[model samples]
Target: MDLKKILWDFFFLLFETGSHSAGSLLRQSPQPRHTLHAGPRLSASASSKELLMKLRRNTGYSFVNCKKALETCGGDLKQAEIWLHKQAQKEGWSKAAKLQGRKTKEGLIGLLQEGNTTVLVEVNCETDFVSRNLKFQQLVQQVALGTMMYCQSLKDQLSTYSKGFLNSSELSGLPAGPDRDGSLKDQLALAIGKLGENMTLKRAAWVKVPSGFYVGSYVHGAMQSPSLHNLVLGKYGALVICETSEQKTNLEDIGRRLGQHVVGMAPLSVGSLDDEPGGEAETKMLSQPYLLDPSITLGQYVQPQGVSVVDFVRFECGEGEEAAETE
Candidate 1:
């Protein structure tokens, strides 16, 4: 039987059987929807959105045309895009003008606390492209979360012996530059350079208390792709950390509750910036609480903008971080 006649017969069956028509067609052979195009496949399956971006960037066409082409070709990107261009001229539809530029800075600021340990870290990249890369973004999150679990109270309050230092592989040898041979900071900087974009530690915080129910944490957007995280992407993400009794709430429950609390009340410092946000950025950011609240004075929270605020590290991205330029 000719392929054309077979298709005609299938369509007739489709009309006769309605929903069952597709099922019958599927039972006979590979479903058309699941079939791949006759060309090289992407490294990973490109999302509909990603494909749309490729079309716009490569062809400088509109989103609508790209979408229509993709659908009309049964997900054949090449054919759909080609059809879009031709249709553009035939229909007098102006080429979808390239969307205006916005430095869609993408990355994430992760916050986590278990027991008395808590930390916040900013992992950023120049363009959304690198930021959205899964490996890059996940590295940032895991590091941030790990730092909170292990480093929070490890090194605070130096005695006559060792300086107030934290534990964890991270502080294994500090005063050792960003890398040791390189620190996480140094490693992050190198990654930014390698990717040809600026990346830096905007800020970080760690907290541990001797007693009391230590606050726990909750992630705002758990289902979001790590690659697509937007740290300075605007008020893009939220982290909720709250102080509660371990006795009253289970550890897992505490994290969820605190996260819920955070969704509502934007607590500053989780307690007090006076001893909260550690690291240089935190010290600088502490001023706002002083500036806004009359209860505290400059003698308390205020610190020289240039001074290091390492003590108050994970307090969310420091209010205003100076940008680094790459040569």
Candidate 2:
């Protein structure tokens, strides 16, 4: 309390009194009725919700992740999308590493045929629910297609190769992604991130038909995809290579039935029907009875139809120990 302090305090006191009087008069005169006003906070909230929905639909990310991205980017759609992709990829890699050891015992077998070559891929997930997801199915189809292209590039060398087996590591470098701009592994990581589940490209195999032979395939329990018509997805699938004297068009029915027979009968080899009457015949494709008309053996069914089952491969989801035993 100096004299200067006292003077300053008095000056502020006088100013406060004048402002109070003005406010009182202003309040008394503010009586406007039926005035319309837009709430800024409500508008902002609605916009945020719309933005979140758009981000979710465009990115196929979780709502929680979408909202967080929007908030982190301050409601910017493009920036949020970039942030989500980066974050999701990072998270996906982390999740995939952590879940790598988990047994992926459920999934689908995807089959795709291009001309005389056909590829079958098995993609495994943790649960059936995740396996049935459209994204997961799309992943399988993409992997199959990518593997087909990879094999096609080796067409010249494949002439001598009976069949080619592709492990995950081999396919990891193949091109994938929505725009075919990323590696297969990156696409897989993204899927794992979005689905929040352990997924693996367990195994893929491709068979190329030799000259004078035709290939036919069937997929049991298949569900048609909205986008891909050439690809078939199901729990069980098979491809049969037949050397037929009949026209390719005429062999279509027998070829498809042979495929079904291989899948349904689970033959170990295309043993000659005359190998013996015992184990060889029992486990031979030709010796097995036709599924459509069980009264006749497959050899008799196709022999009269001018079809000879040259070779076949079958795939079943989660076959595990039973599959090994059969092999």
Candidate 1 C-alpha RMSD relative to the actual structure? 17.2
- Where is model 2 poorest over a 10-residue stretch in terms of lDDT? 318-327
lDDT of 1 by residue, 108-179 (tens): 656544544555555555565776665456546545544553464355662211112233233322232221
Best by lDDT: 2
Off by over 4 Å in 2: 1-52, 67-79, 157-162, 277-281, 321-327
Candidate 2 Cα lDDT to native: 0.80
Give the least accurate 10-residue stretch of model 1, judged by summed lDDT: 93-102
| Model 2: pairs clashing at backbone N, Cα or C within 3 Å | none
Show where candidate 1 strays beyond 4 Å.
Answer: 1-105, 112-115, 138-181, 223-246, 249-251, 264-319, 322-327
Q: How high is the lDDT of residue 327 in model 2?
A: 22
